[model samples]
Target: MSAIIQIKNVTKEFKVLNRREGLKGSLKDLFSRDYKIVRAVDNISMDIEQGEIVGYLGPNGAGKSTTIKMMTGVLEPTSGEILVGGNIPYQNRAKNAQEIGVVFGQRSQLWWALPLIESFKLLKDIYQISDSDYKSMMHLYQSLVDIEPLLHKPVRQMSLGQRTLSDILAAFLHNPKIVFLDEPTIGLDVSMKSKIRILINALNKEKNTTVILTTHDMGDVDALCRRIVIIDKGKMLYNNDIEHLKGFFGSYRTLKIRMDGDLKQQAEVIQKELPDFSVSADEEWISVLVDEEKSKVMEVLNQLQKSHEIRDMQLEEISTEDVIKKIYEEGVE
Candidate 1:
């Protein structure tokens, strides 16, 4: 199947003006601005198919939002090509808006004083959604989110989760083929986050909606996205299956050992014995990083067991968050 979205050599740059310090400099800046081009996105490209939930991840100011804005037609790229649903996003704004839905976590689309259902109805009119289509969408959304009870309450009266759920419904009221969700689960409690994730999953299962989600939550990436596109410093770091990313960054393993006896002396001994490994010690447990080739799990266990009584032990691989951090700190190839 052809990709629903194709981004080729997409680059976006913004002119940043230098601020003046003194009164004279401030006045000068207004008249003659000292500006430099800041590359928000640098020749990044990817393909996203229908029915795929992709996690677009990066640290703060890594151009994650910039990329999303370009995709949703909110911003134009400085150079390169972008096609969403066979239409140029920035060029054909109206047509692209009809096929796409966007939810920004920091902003609320629903009116504060209006009831949730009232807001949804307004969206229905704006989108020109058929009555039948509106009813069907409401049925599916209500079944997944169970938000019917909160529909009558004003947005200001609802909790964070309730407002977020309402916002999601408003975005999708038009039954857009593609959706862009920016930190949808931010600042929500665990239970509420789970609810939103479940609703997204159900939507994908039933409607095959193509979703591009940007979040810092590793759990969200693991649960929702089969593919991940990681960016850092306005550049693409990795774009591949989640498994491939895990394998690429999952080189080091951690060994956590619980000690039956006093850990102070034993921890010192282990550290002294394994000079090449990175070690940390607490009251009851000793942790060390082991390179798979240089050191094996069995050797570490066997060596540690000779002196101290090993109460329990476990091996932990690098997590998704760790991999992402590594990429940002030391640029991934």
Candidate 2:
């Protein structure tokens, strides 16, 4: 599979006005424009293959949004090159628009006063979709989302979840080759989030639609993305498969064991035996934090079984959220 999207050394810079304090200073700044350069996306490069869903993540003020805008031709890059489906996005926006679909979680592209079905019809006309294709898409979308009840309702009168679902349906109505979903599940309830994810997965698998998802939700990344590209402070921090990213910080594991006898005594014994490991206890379980490189879980369990009776045990690995938090706080190692 060849790369469908290629971004090389892309950079986006903006000139932000310097606002002065107080009314007098603010009045003075109106005539004289004092500005500072802000590089929202700095020297980033990545390749996204067709039919792959890549998670684009970062902390607030990161360049995730800037990069997306550039890719969608909303904003032109200051430097470097971007090729989407062999065409420059900024240079060929109209052509690219026909190939790509976009959904902004906080913003709606639908007609505000019109019925949801009317908005979809408007999109179908704009995209020049055929009657057969429209029916096929509606059939597939209806299976994923129960959109019939809300189709006749005005978009402004619908709930957030309903509107979001309608927005997603509109984005894919054209059956574009690539999709950009920015916080598609934001502000949605758990069940709604799950439903959206399932629909996204189905689209990707069934149609081979390439997706670039920008989201703060780890659940979205975990469920839909096998590959992730992480950026912070306008720089690319990590770009790899999900498992490989986990392996970068997979040296530690947590063990929660259920013991038959006194939990505190068991914790104390384990702590004394493995002084290097961190051990704690509650009413029923003894928790041991183990560095797999320094000491193995089997080794600790072997020692514990000799002194105490173990009923059950669970070994856990580090979570994606924890790894991402560490990267944001400490920078990538």
Candidate 3:
């Protein structure tokens, strides 16, 4: 089947004023000001298929949001073409919007003063949804989440998790073909985070809705995304399934050890000694990635014994988080 969304060499640029320093610079007689062009989304491209959940991974200012805005029609690309469901989003925003749903972090699409049910009804009217469609959406949502207790409560009165969950439900209420979730689980408690993940997975399976998720939480990615796209500094770094991405670092194991030494300082030393492997701290443990293909785990540890002492250790397969970190440190080869 053809892709539901297609992006070809898309790029979005912005012009920012280069303000001078000091009060004299700020004044500048209001006549001379320097501006520079910034490429927030560079020449990057990808295809999103229907009924698939993709994790849009990136650091701050990595252009994930910019790409999403272009997909949703909030902004148009400065170059290249973006077609969402066979329609140009920026050119036909109204039609594009009807088929796509968006939920931004820290932003609620529901009415603050209205009850959850009232908000749902308002969305139904605004989307011109049929009565049958409305009923089905309610039925599906209620099945996924017990909304009876919170249905009558105003949105503002709901807790943070409740509000985030409600916003997600409302976004899917119209049964749009595509849903963009931006940090949907941000700031939610552990239990609430699990609930939101389950709700989303269930919705995708039941409705076959395509999901484009942007998140920093690795737990969310593990629970929700089978495939992920990694970008940094407005450039596409990696695009593939989690397994394929991990395969890039095959024969690598994470060696976690607990020691009495200062973990932060020791981790830096180990990283320097084993420049090929990535090292980090996890609470009481100093974690290091041991590339068995390059050097046996014991051989690597034997060298580390030169200065640091290991009290206890455990080894595990390279994880998604580890792969991401390694990629950031060293680009995909």
Clashes of each: 0, 0, 0
Model 3 TM: 0.90
Predicted candidate 2 versus true structure: per-residue lDDT over 175-284, tens digit per residue: 88889999999999999999889999998887899999999999999999999999999999999999888767657788889977788887897799888887999987
The candidate maximizing TM-score is 1
Candidate 1 C-alpha lDDT tens digits along 1-333: 779999999999999998778999888998875798999999999999998999999999999999999998889999999999999999999999999999987678889999988988888888889999999998988677777688899999988888888888788789898999999999999998888898888887888999899998988897899999999878899999988886675467889998766677777788998897877878767888787777787898788788667888888987777777778788875
How well does candidate 2 match the true structure, expressed as C-alpha RMSD? 3.6
How many residue pairs in model 2 have overlapping backbones? 0
Give the runs in model 3 whose Cα sits over 4 Å from its true position.
258-286, 298-311
Global Cα lDDT for candidate 1: 0.87
Give stretches of model 1 more than 4 Å off.
Answer: 20-28, 260-272, 282-284, 307-309
User: Model 2 misses residue 232 by how many Å?
Assistant: 0.3
TM-score of each: 0.92, 0.86, 0.90
- Candidate 2 Cα lDDT to native: 0.90
Lowest summed lDDT across 10 adjacent residues in model 2 is found at: 245-254
The TM-score of predicted model 1 comes to 0.92
Show where candidate 2 strays beyond 4 Å.
22-28, 31-33, 256-289, 298-314
Candidates sorted on lDDT, descending = 3, 2, 1
